[model samples]
Target: MKAMIKVTLKNGVLDPQGKAIMGSLQSLGFNGYDNVRQGKYFELDIEAFSKEEAKARATDMCEQLLANTVIENYEIEIV
Candidate 1:
């Protein structure tokens, strides 16, 4: 089974890196973009009997280490 995890900042959180990217984009003439949010992606190959199991395991991984629960949100996909 393959597990895909996406970690991103929660709403109302400050993102300096995203701000810097947006600034650079405008300077490079990539206009009309209002915001740029950054995130983390992880792909894992694991042994699981079903999609549910794979998603559960990936969720555990995110909560334990991959994501900062207090300030971040995570989504799990099994493929």
Candidate 2:
């Protein structure tokens, strides 16, 4: 089984890296972009009997290490 995970900061959190990227974009003459945010993506292959199991395992992984539950949110897609 394969799991695709996306981890992003929750609203109201400060993103200094995102701000720096936006500033660099503007300096490079890239216009019309209002804001930019950064996130994490992960692709994992694991042993699972079903799609549901894959998702469950992915969710567990996120809760344990992939994401910081207090400030980051995660989504899982199983294939």
Top candidate when judged by TM-score against the true structure: 1
| Cα lDDT tens digits for candidate 1, 20-65 | 9899998998986686999999998989998988888888899899
C-alpha TM-scores of all predictions: 0.95, 0.94
User: 60 in model 1: Cα distance from truth in Å?
Assistant: 0.8
Runs in model 2 deviating more than 4 A are none
- In the order shown, the candidates' Cα RMSDs to the true structure are 0.7, 0.9
Clashing pairs in 1: none
Q: For candidate 2, write residues 10-78 as lDDT tens digits.
A: 999998899999999999999988759899999999799999988988999999999999999999998
Each model's lDDT comes to 0.91, 0.93
Give per-residue lDDT, candidate 2, residue 21.
Answer: 93
Q: Under the 3 Å rule for N, CA and C atoms, how many clashes does model 1 have?
A: 0
Error of 1 at 30 (Å): 0.5
Candidate 1 global TM-score: 0.95
lDDT of 2 at 6: 99
